[model samples]
Target: MEMVERYIYAVTQRLPQGQRIDIAEELRGLIEDMLEERNDGRPVENTDIERVLIELGSPAELAEEYRGTSRFLVGPDLFPAYLSVMKMVLIITVSAMGIIFAVETILTPMSILHHFVDLLISLFVTATQVFAWITAGFAAAQYFGVAPPGLSGGYNRKNWNPSELPPVPDKKKQIKRGDVLTGIIFSILLLVLVRFSNHLFGVLLFEDHHLEATIPFLNEEKLLELMPLIYLMVAIGIVKEISKLMAGRWTKNLAIANLVINGAIFLLAMFILRDQAILNPDFVQQLSDSWGISKQQEEYTTIKTVWKLSYNLALAAFVITLLIDTVTGFYKAFRK
Candidate 1:
């Protein structure tokens, strides 16, 4: 029957590839036998097949039973915890990646169409990687019989302690996952951009619907020199974001971690910005030429000076913003 075939397909699809054909055949035979018994030796029809399948239950459940393992990628005992953690990781990862992408698009001048295409590809790849890794981590934990932290003895009443319960989190003081995710994404993208600026940071010019020129803005040597510190900062940022996501609200520990990360970032930013040779000379020359500054000697010097000043000012503004955020977090975390 068509229903029989469809039902068999559903069950077999959940099974291992090698087992599908044999399992499907066996399941079909059982269904036919059951239908014959139900129909009193009459021919089985699609409705009979449907009735048989309904009595047997869902395909996934039947497949699992046939496999002789009650366990899933995540067992029932750990499912609640798994779900929570999975949601947090997914939200953080997606949010962070999105923020980084937006920042990259804004900071780096590029063709809108090209940037959108690049972003779509990057997001798809990154999202898939993040989801697979997070799911695998949880699945491995489930398989290993590892319990989620703070869920002692699997939600037993014996472990309850009213006195040990944390104070009610202030709703206004909640640490938003979206915000934390954005920060994490920003840090990660910054790390990647800084680490691979030579390849990624370039200006493309088009003329008559054809690419005319390309110019890179960063010196590879200088960027490479800052990789270690940049990596450290990025790692710290990721850790902080994860902590914030887990806590779900501002707390002293998270606030302190945020402060430390911000401080470290500020120091690194200062160090990186102080390098006079960090900017690619050729890029500057090209930019100057494009601005038509080379033709006016007096204007060239003044404009160059203004550009350098603006660069320092931008860095300063970033540091100041970090300081403000750190202070606000500290105050909110510690104050009544």
Candidate 2:
């Protein structure tokens, strides 16, 4: 009878979620009827259950019959997660690239058409890459015998309890896969930009139908020196975001991980910010020149003071937001 429950679980889990309860009940009745007919109302043992299961056939074959088809590249267990991840990645990547394209178009109206074409090409390339990598990862995971818990062999319907199921996330409080994917993309972009900050964050001067990168905000030497810490923080963030995406909801363990990663990031940021010479002197000088304010002038002094204040404020805001997020994660995971 225990094996019968497991057999039902194995089959019904592969069926549509909406049909699972009904099919499970029906299967139980049918199995009992068969056992009753066989044992003539005697107490059914494990041998009887095994024989009934063997007659009913393997769970996979039975599931296929219920599903009405055998066509699949990825098994039912992994397909939902695969589709969700692909959709999330495409949405985030396309939206981010579209925003950048829009900004470029606005900055240079004469090349709007050219930029639009470039945007299309960029979108296609990015989408293709994301799709390929996500699919490959899931495929590899599946091939290696890693799978979602209920989809494989371990789940037993008899052991299933309502309390063990995760709370149905309130629409307002839910952590969406798209959000996690967006975070991953943002972190990846940060890693890329920081690793090549001299090229990506430079002051752009447009002249004679061309754009020239004049100087960058961060000192090259200081930026390179900070790369080790920065890379570690960003790598941690990427892994955390990926874990959240796979989990598809907040849990106590994930909340703890989030808190730890956020704390590490904040500490690394503070260490980097403590260095006064992190910003390039030439960048400040160029800014002062552009604003027609001499280094000795009160206006230049005021500008520098404002810049420092803004930087500190931004850092404070970043830390506050991270803390708020970590707390919110815990609340979501632990709330009644």
Candidate 3:
């Protein structure tokens, strides 16, 4: 009986100070009652106490039951918030993964379907972690009794009085010129940083002619080879910057314009490259030798499938980005 009392005290010690003594006393009384009924007026022993405790259940589970109907980790009220954040995060992550898969399919000679499956798995794992972290923070806050700072204090309930509510602000007062200008400047700086890093790497490591000819379109001897890529990059960057500065129908229009410009450049490059048969002779011979196709048939069928896929991928990327930008623009416009 003494051993049982000590064990109960030890288990209940970690509970809040206000809850500890009452829970401990109740548990002690229940154990005593159980022992009394079991012994039939005989002396109680340690084994009897142990058997009773075991039948009652684990101390941790008992503590959890006692602490039930209270907010700790994710309570019923906050589950929606947890699920909403998780859903939004997963959507964003999948979209980003799709963009990544498109780029990888374009640049690499790997199987597109296989890479896409791998990307989906990777995105799911990443989204799980992100959602876990978000929910964990909320759980931690509820456990610690610390409400998130700067959010509404009162719950939205039925019979809530309008007089008790704070005055609503004018919608027109929300727009700030300085805030918009700051966002535009920050966005431009980020784009500039990316461009600068790419240019630096291009000049230093990729300047050599030996590495240049390995890529189909980057060969120096190929006239106007890089014009398409340059035009596409510049057009996309400008459209992104314009969208940030002024969102609405105009932003969607700009995105469409960028996509059209990039598509045109890609088509022009394909026409020129195909006419010159840049990937014809050597690529055909390699394919025939590897696949056991006859040499005469190789010339007719062996095309630069990888290079063509890359061009198509670039066009696809622009279209996808445009679609995302257009949707986001309309969402923000309405949200404002």
lDDT ranking, high to low: 2, 1, 3
* TM-scores of all predicted structures: 0.62, 0.62, 0.39
What is the per-residue lDDT of model 1 for residues 1-336, given as tens digits with 9 covering 90 to 100?
887788788888877799988988898889878988999978777777778889999988898888887757876666776677667666666665565666556545466567778778877887788778867887887778665554322343457667666567687788886787677767767766665566456665667655455565677787677678768777877787777766777888878888887788777767766756677766656766866768468877775677678667877788788889998888878777
- RMSD, one per candidate, in order: 7.8, 12.6, 14.2
What TM-score would you give candidate 2 relative to the actual structure? 0.62
Where does model 3 exceed 4 Å of error?
1-41, 45-71, 111-114, 117-121, 144-336
Clashes of 2: 0
Question: Relative to the true structure, how large is the alpha-carbon lDDT of every model?
Answer: 0.73, 0.77, 0.55
Q: What lDDT would candidate 2 get against the real structure?
A: 0.77
State the TM-score for model 3: 0.39
**Please, what are the lDDT tens digits per residue for candidate 2 over residues 200-290?**
5656656776654446667889988888888888888878887776556777888898898888888888887676566776776777786
Q: In every candidate, how many clashes are there?
A: 1, 0, 0
Judged by lDDT against the true structure, how good is candidate 3?
A: 0.55
Best by lDDT: 2
